[model samples]
Target chain A: MKARGGVDWMVVVSRLVFSGVFVWAGWGKLRDPLAFADSVAAFRMLPHPVFVSLVALGVPVLEWMTAVLLWVPRWHRAARWVMTGLFALFAVALSVAQVRGLEIDCGCFGSGEPTKWSVPLAWGRAVGLLGWAIWYGWRVRGRSADQ
Target chain B: MREGLREEGLRMAVMVAGSLVLGAVVNGVRSDSVPWEYEPKAQRMSRELARVGIKEGETREVAAGAIELGEFAGMVREKSVLVIDARAPLFYRMGHVAGAINLPREGFASFLERSGLLGKDKSRAVVVYCQSETCEDSRMVAESLRRVGFTSVRVFREGWRRWLESGEPVEKPS
Candidate 1:
């Protein structure tokens, strides 16, 4: 019982950390949509300017909402999956850009000078986040079953 | 396990739909919905140009000097023009056209000193470029030069992409 309680506490802490990070990142990106779009455009993954603009606008909002949902115990299972999917996509994108030898800003937090984080480091961070989300998802599922 | 996966998938789908609607709403409410129309960086670049004594009337000349890759290459060969790469330091380090100096748009002021551009004659023909046609750092840097009293500044609108595609010689920092 003590072990189970400790596990639950760990999940809660992870949830808080994830929520805090996304909210901060989303708010920052929302403040400068054009700069964010420019960073996205640098990857050259998206072909259309309009689509890039839409992504620039959409991603922050998605992140903010998902972050909020993750904090809600009842919604944790669904939100965890969304966060995992998003982080996985980010990891893949960063890896692809690195492989292509394209130098680009991650645009994860907002727009700034040349990315301080190397491509490998950025991908690792995203993958790490995805792992946390997966763990949270499993924990939430187990909790529901216990109830 | 299968039932849980199905439930999670359905919930995720609903969340995705909700997020899309929310994003659309947030974007619509923001002033930057038009993208290019509201770049604060560009505005700052214009202001920086103004600081260097360029007036409103002279800005027309500043904006008119767009040049093609071939002409830019000619200027490089004939006039030995100073070529400025207005991209981030990392990108600049990765690769750049031969004899080009990096002076990214945001850090134009500091780079001006570091690149020894301030010591050169203002009348010397100068060319500035960035990533590609879609990128505006080249234009921004060109305007900065013009405003700083450079007598001749040309923006290579096609920028790095055209130069690379044309098989122009490139140099990476050693």
Candidate 2:
């Protein structure tokens, strides 16, 4: 395959790091679905029934799939988009919870007491990840003919 | 070049669709009210315990929310029930449930054992209360009791503050 615009090394590094983090988080939740449910309930975003159901099943699958797709060469670009979208969703949810003064755990890492969201941290992570995705997409578009 | 762009667009569309579908399916399955396998039976037991004002091993039963000052005075005449205040040591020292032993949340585990309270005749009713309904310290202590084979464990959800506010009998800290 042709090299894409001299290879965006920063994008590559970000993808790997984010993918690893997702994998680690997903695996921990997979080990204890009930605990994750409790964490989700603490957020108070949805009804208990709906929240419990999602955390018990949907969360782990999404996390694992996103993590796996990140490393696969064929799925790299698509995975980056999906991961970026997911993180963006998370940032939005956290922002709303903070504004509402809902002291619930982020549920990003299973069950625990509710933690305060750091706005700066959330923005930094979101921007960095989304930037990598955009860079990778731009590179691929420019080098399409060679590939 | 046009062909390459078209292919890439198609690929992106497919990937997006796949992710959305997966998310929907997972959320759909989870939104159902089915109980998960990992949630311990202790949750149900706690609910039940809260409903009835009787401890796990004790024979005497008090009305739920009967921990008011007047009620505590009337209820404790026989010394059949043990009202355990499950607040922090500092809070307990300031004042607690009248005649209630101070079982601070942190010291409860060993206190139950060392104080000979754990295996004491199950007939002695144990009423565990904490700061209030939102405080989980009492529920946790009650759950611990059940796990240790204590038959009766009642959580006084109203906790010490309610008991004090009700103007029940209270002894100042010595």
Candidate 3:
């Protein structure tokens, strides 16, 4: 990330890096979505199987789509919005699970993730990601292509 | 300004909708794809009971000293908890939680006698599991363990189905 001749190269590089994060995250969950569904069930918020499956499948696909769309010049801003919305949703889910005193896998990356991060830590990570998306969105506002 | 905002909103909507449709498509193609929707054991059992015209609470209520899969897996991995299979010998022979002992619900007393578990330490953390939450055997066996002075008995209500689904270790005893 750097500044070069009236173009904020930092913004360009940051967007690229951010898109990779989405790809890695999406692929991790896509590897075993059933296990991901189990992680979704751990939340206990949506006890219905349809809701569980929807979230389990929807989240990763959105992430992958976000990753791909981020590179498209016209779709860049919209992808940022989608990424921001996803993180905001994640923050809410993680916060609720934390407040309910539920001890379960975060499922931010994938199911059966070995790290065992506390719910609070995972919540913090989601909020951090949310902040990044919002920041990028702010930087790119009003600028058309390559923003 | 308004026009640009409208276009962004439309594209965002497209991305989200595309994701939903694609999610189903991907699941349909994958060999290991979960059933379109998972039917939890308790829900399935209740539906079956309604189909048979049997009402709820027809049998004695068993206590739910339930342990979720994450905690149960940890206990199993750590080998700190004594895991017990509440199924019969047939299921036990096929596969079971690693290091778990079989104490069939039907022959609870007889197995208890043969296994000599009565003399074991009662204060240890013990987890009892069966094939599915649809069956009450694990809960009943857990209740029995509690009665026999097992102080820290827990029922892995999700049991073997969840354990297998979660990709936890399974042992087929030779």
TM-scores, in order shown? 0.58, 0.50, 0.60
TM-score of 3: 0.60
Please tell me which model should have the higher DockQ, number 1 or number 3: 3
Query: Which 10-residue window of candidate 1 chain A scores lowest in summed lDDT?
Result: A1-10
Strongest candidate by lDDT = 3
Which candidate would rank higher by lDDT, 1 or 3? Answer: 3
lDDT of 2 by residue, B90-112 (tens): 67788876677766534355566
Error of 2 at B100 (Å): 19
Q: List the residue pairs that clash in candidate 3.
A: none
Model 3, span B32-68: residue lDDT tens: 5756676543443344344434445322326667899
Q: Considering only the true interface residues, what is the Cα RMSD of candidate 3 after superposition?
A: 5.0
Give a tens-digit lDDT track for model 3, residues A60-124.
Answer: 99999998888788788898888889889989999999888876777777754322356888899
Better of 2 and 3 by TM-score: 3
Give stretches of model 2 more than 4 Å off: A1-7, A116-147, B1-119, B122-174
> Which of the predicted structures, 1 or 3, would earn the higher TM-score when compared with the native?
3
Per-residue lDDT, model 2, residue A125, is 66
When 2 and 3 are scored with DockQ, the better candidate is 3
DockQ, Cα level, model 3? 0.39
Task: Indicate the docking level reached by candidate 1.
Answer: incorrect
